[model samples]
Target chain A: MSVPNAQRQIDMLTKMLRIREFEERVKRTFTDHPGVIRGHTHLADGAEASIVGSLSHFKKGDAALATYRCHGYPIALGTDTKAMMAEILGRVDGLCKGLGGSMHLTDVKKGFLGTSGIVGAGIPHAAGAAWAAQIRKKREVVFCFFGDGASKQGAFAETLNIASLWKLPVIFVMENNGYNVVTTSAQEDANAAAGQPLSIKAKSFAMPGVTVDGTDPLAVAAAVGKAVRRARRGDGPTLVESKVYRLSAHGNIIAPPGVPLHYPEHEAITVFGKREEYEAALRGDPVPRFRGILVQNGTLTAAAADAITQKVVAEMEAAVKFAVASPYPKLESALDHVYA
Target chain B: MAQLPYIAAIDAGIHQEMRRDPSVLYFGQNLATTENHEFVAAYGHDRVRVTPISETAEIGMAIGAAMAGFRPVVELYMAEFMLVAMDQVLNEAPKFRYMSGGQVKVPLVLKAGFGFACGWAGQHTGSLTALFMGVPGLKVVVPSTAADAKGLMATSIRDDNPVVFMHHYLLTLEHGEVPDGEHLVPFGQAAIRRTGGDVTLVATGWMVNRALAAAEALAKEGIQAEVIDPRTVAPLDLDTILKSVAKTGRLVVVDQAPRHATVGGIIAADVVEHGFESLRAPIIQVNARDTTVPYSEPLEAYVIPDEARICAAVRKVCKTAR
Candidate 1:
């Protein structure tokens, strides 16, 4: 439960940089290689520190499930970015054989079980996996990720109650990005409107609730690491409200086939006209903020950070090339996998 | 073989799988509340425990457990309870294997009872077989006998897909000879309850008994009817119905659900499209009246398909000529 050492800190920063770079490529795909990616694509540029830190404690036997803002978890879990990109581009070599697009990226082999496009639906699914882990008696845990909006869903309440009652080994990580699509948390969430942290809702279920600065990887790691240990010890589930800001709009503008799709400006500026708030979030963007902290603390040198950045940029660049060059799946293969 | 009630046969099927596969889990609302409960006694609490009245979590947990390499049978008790968690039942459980491109198999069973028309009233007495039968990735099983109940439940557990095993509430205590052990009835096969030449009677679940009684009445009237019970509706045995139609040259479909929601309508459409030449008469469908089943006994009886309705439909089909 102690702070991650220098090596682990550098590793966490590397992962955050990879996620930021991968999300940038996905955003650029709208213009750089128009029409290559289809459907709604959510970006995880701002939540990288929280994602990487929580998953840093992941082990071989553990499992993780997340919302559609899913690209970051797999990257931290060591999934092949090439296959992930191919999946987003609907290619034969895709992670899910092109059947599941960006929203449903899954790598069971890597213990990244799957993602649910619907808000709050995947929460109970994580508890279900935790039940399996409990039955296995291996002290393994499950990490369940969703947004602050998902906390309003009935699945969240039902699952939290049952998870605590059964003492299921799962962590409910709510990334409070301040918005559920275009609606702000204060508009939709009772706790937020009352000026209470969303984590306070967990008290009703009789489990520990903690709020952390999601923009800091070390903070998230420390908080989530304690919960992981408690879960491993069969204590019960915990609810961690990791507060972060989404760097992009909820997703690319949804449109018909004839009209082109693209990512719009963040709702802070576009919908709420709060340019100053958006500017503040941009200045505190976790990816660069973590890098600056590492340099100031002497855990990482400028040259080392730059080298890591160059490698991740080249890695993602190759992923885009490979994905664009990959061929579409066979038309008839659509009929496959309808039944197992 | 041994004589067992429909409910016990279903339990036998579950016990059959749970005994062999330690990974098979049976849990639901209010079933295993005590340690001495039958399932918890046999399999222990790790594999059997009582869940809260959270349908969404119950089915969703089953899907997650299934993905993690365990076969879970969620004891839903009533099919209408599934409506409370349609997203998990319709979207999540069935879509995982397909959306994951076969990378994960959701091998689980949703055991729910349907068609309890004995004064249970509208909300509790619906025959919702057709609602689940048409979902692409779901397998819907409607067993009409104790033997088929044990066998189909076994097969549903073994099948590597999401299965909705809809057992009729009226048949909970109906006794029949079930196989002693390892009884597994394959899906997508029809059971010919009776064979005749004048008309073919196609039905499922409780309607099969009504169709059989109607066939007997039709036999006495010199209009022989062949009764066909399609055990599993999703992987429907259309070929058997077509072949039966070819021999009888007349078709009569009886369903306990409303007219539009009847699986018979789907089967009738398939027959008309695929076996039009085999029919000497227009297919007659005898479905329940399109209304909520009333609480009154007579009104409920009038709303549901009965032996008289099936016999009337069969006789009507037999009267038509090529």
Candidate 2:
């Protein structure tokens, strides 16, 4: 597999920073602009390296589907962040016209097909898109992203079995963040209890499985690039377990109307009382670590890195301003688009 | 026109679309297994293949494929099998278009047999037309006649939305004269099987035949009962039913599902609300008794609606009006 060039590496850093900055504004929206985002919104604060690196192999014809922690994928795919923010803010200018909001951010034109609020649900959808690509006689592949918790779902097993059997061109990316909504992986996952990597589940479906450090962009890119090649070659699917840390809680606290919503403490601290573990994750945060690597290797000057940071910050700030100023969709529009 | 059984006509409808549109796909469990399989031989392996008995994946993949610009028809033998993947059926397939704000269209069909009261017992024998009709993005089709079976299937495949094409198992081998080519039945149009001015009888799927038989029996008693079959329930033809009620001044609705779960109740509520003044007597509904469809033959016969019960309900409505 070809390594991303120095310029490409710097581009990856820029996308990673964009994701981090975009989501940081989303988290702050709960407090900075109270009640702008409604319902449960999961942030991809720590999975930037994983999200950006895996998508680095994406091409024009390729498609990707993800779970509810979905803001980062569309941002990395170059969807207008202003519309994404408008969607989160429930404005008419939103990506889905405020119908789907943060949990269901979809940009079909960019090949980020859709997102599923249900876990393990979007896996077969990617395989379905892969089937379409297969019929088109194109080497297009689909990237299926889900969390470690989704592996236990029946959809996961059933989809993997069929995907492998049909030799469909799709890559399964499981972001192993070690938590499934307040429960650690060991408490629920059999492989985790046995001290085996979650990637081992791919063996049951007769496909190659690999585990990589998700915080390292190059590591994730190299691993996912190999799988993309396998899929494009029509050899079948490969499961890549990119192990990362969920630096935030599962989502903002779910509250009834009139109660202010905001992000809670990391489950490692709130539920398990492991402050140091949470602190350690923050220290090894992927965004700065990748930036440090680029600076150390002379791919980016420290001055250039600061400039990129300032640019992303301003872009996201403008997105927030545009979103908060936008108007809500007309009440009658709720009846539209229900049939076709 | 050619004489065709309901099951064959459904296949003919699929063949019609597969011949016309290259993007139409047909796949499910226990189908197209070998080289000589009809669909495989006809469309090749790329568009037709057998899948494992994984309902969630089978339906889920169809949704993905539909969104990606292929029209897929999933052959689920029994309606209850959809319960195994209701999330994909009810939640995923129907919600994608609206959720995407018209960005994508899921043009697919879920073909399943329902109301199989021929000793299939509780699980397999369910009239689930009402369950899907209420869902916004889904179009529910219940074709009673062989001709309608072919026509409605064609319309469903061509429509740019998710459709649940429910064919009654009891009517699978029933034969009728189906048009030879490209016969398309529009959704939301009710078929008036018999026209009369004394009393109106409304039904769907297997119950349409039962209602027709009851209409014949009612004619001997000097009760001219008008019979209407709503080919599609989602876009229900309330206007025709209301117009029939206006002429007849009496009504009886027959459904094979339990009383509480019948589409008859929904129609009754609509007629009463919209056409209440036209009603000369309280409407009567001949629905199955509320219980798990029993395994015993006698119990099954007693629990579901039959021609005798439909006739009795029609007579009661006619008598009550006078």
Candidate 3:
């Protein structure tokens, strides 16, 4: 096991905690206010490490596109969380001036080209951005973050073909969260065992492919680091498959604790392993796991981790307050942006 | 004044725009095989990119490129292919500016060859101006003549919005005098093709040419039809059409699209609603038969609105059937 340095682990832990707390806070806000965050949200509860890990390798010129579960990405990309929270709340002071809502948080200056609600749509956007990078000689690389459901979209295949053909600097980060909405991959495909791993599908396009345990932030960062290096060196694109689980409903709209198994036991077991393993992966979430390792390695103590949590909590509290206080857009200004 | 074929004028116009601005580039399939070779020779391969035949991805790619500060003119080969990229067209590109709250401007022009008279059967023949008109942020332009084609090509490229530029297949074969250089036609302005007072003939795309011919035919019969060509739709020159309608007190709309929810239908509705007080007779709209265009030349001609159909609409609106 190649463990990253103590500092890297601490940083990942902090990011993971921020993501978890943000989603948790968003979930709580939505529950309490009901209509506070107007649009639907795809919370990033279990898939924190996959985004933060890969983005850790992202630089100033690098651009990233993610699916609708975008709150985590912009937050990790260093966007103004207050504005993002305001945007989700549909306040005029939001990042997108309250137009984007939860599904479309974007800050071009922050190198988050944006997020799309379309399942596999962001794939081509990344490929084109990478092409732009090459055309401008920007030496910029693009990272596309999508989910298991997106793999089924034709856009995923089309973008892969184009990216490899042009040798564009792009990384296809498949956050395999076990299920495509309610149907797990095993349920959707009768022979999940026989099928090649998702990353191996990159072989047809002659691009490098690798899989990592998404629960381990170190593993994701390492795999993505190599891909980013290869891309920066002009070695074309790579398909990096990070195995994770949603750990929540597709949108978490109506899901509650102790919800009945929507699918079969064999399906759930096949995806995350035995019940104990599946439960442990959720309970020993990467955020706490990394903190534990940091303590064991004498990097930091539990009190310090709690302190970090307190800081993040206070920050999110301020963001929500700012969003709640922000004004709604004027009704007459609705027709303003229809053109240029 | 330099006379050139409609295709050459548009090609030269694009080349001129590309030279004027380094940001303007082309993305389509087989630029080396088609009319885009001149583009490659002039601008090199980096700017004139011959993309693989993936309409959906290419549209998204073009939208992305536009979002990333490049003015890309993406060709859909035939307007029929716009169906494949409907998501990118109606949903993605059109909604980008509005949904982004004007933070992002999509200075992208999607060019496609549109018609039913080309003898290219059902799947290839499509007049989709109406389809685009339904979307709020999409601008649809169909320039009928070589001069207008060149001028409008430059204007659409320069515009900071998503404009659908359709080159009529038959119009491309027509020769006309094009302004030598830097000819620009602003959108939302209608060109008065012929002046008369008896009836107003409103047309678009190649139908403009047909309407002009119909107006000439009516002139010989003493009908005195005024012909107005709306160079662009969506910002449809409502003032020009309504002014002509008010002057003539009778309106006949000519369009190549089918009758159902087509551009002709929309124009007719607008005339009936806003130009109601200026009507001498019930407004007449001459559109193609609502059926899949057949491959045979005669059937193709039958499917598309032509001079005879336009003249007939004019006569009916004038109540002077002869």
Task: Provide the TM-score of chain A alone for each candidate, in the order shown.
Answer: 0.99, 0.99, 0.90
In the range A1-340, model 3's lDDT, one tens digit per residue, is 3556777778778888888887777777865655676536777877888888889888998888887888888878888888888888888888888777888888888888867788888788788788777788767899899987787777888888888988889999999887786576766643344576778778877899898988778889999989988888888999999988766556744345444213123224555456775676578577777778778878988899889989999988888888888899887777788999
What is the C-alpha DockQ of each candidate? 0.82, 0.83, 0.65
Better of 1 and 3 by lDDT: 1
Error of 2 at B88 (Å): 0.5
lDDT of each: 0.93, 0.94, 0.82
Order the candidates by lDDT, highest first. Answer: 2, 1, 3
lDDT of 2 by residue, B1-322 (tens): 9999999999999999999999999999999999999999999999998999999999999989998999999999999999999999899998888888789899999999999997988899999889998899999999999999999999999999999999999999999999998899999999999999998899999999999988888899898889999999988999999999999888899999999898999999999999999999999999999999998999999999999998888777777885
Candidate 3 stretches with Cα past 4 Å from truth are A1-5, A189-193, A254-278, B33-36, B320-322
The better candidate by DockQ, 1 or 2, is 2
Error of 2 at B47 (Å): 0.4
Report the C-alpha lDDT of model 3 over B1-322, residue by residue, as the tens digit: 8989998888877887999998897878766555457777778766777777788788887877787788889877788887877878887888767766677788888999887477678887777788888789899898988998999999999999989998888787799999987899889999998999999888887888888888888889899988888889877988998999889999888877778847877888998999889888988889889898899989888888888888887778778422
Clashing residue pairs, backbone N/CA/C < 3 A, model 2: none
Off by over 4 Å in 2: none
RMSD of 2: 0.8
lDDT string, candidate 2, A1-340, tens digits = 6789999999999999999999999988889999788899999989999999999999998999999899999998999999999999989999999888888899999998998899988888888988999999789999999999999998999999999999999999999998999999999999999999999999999999999999999999999999999999999999999999999999999899999999999999999999999999999999999999999989989999999999999999999999999999999999878988
Give me the chain B TM-score of candidate 2.
0.99
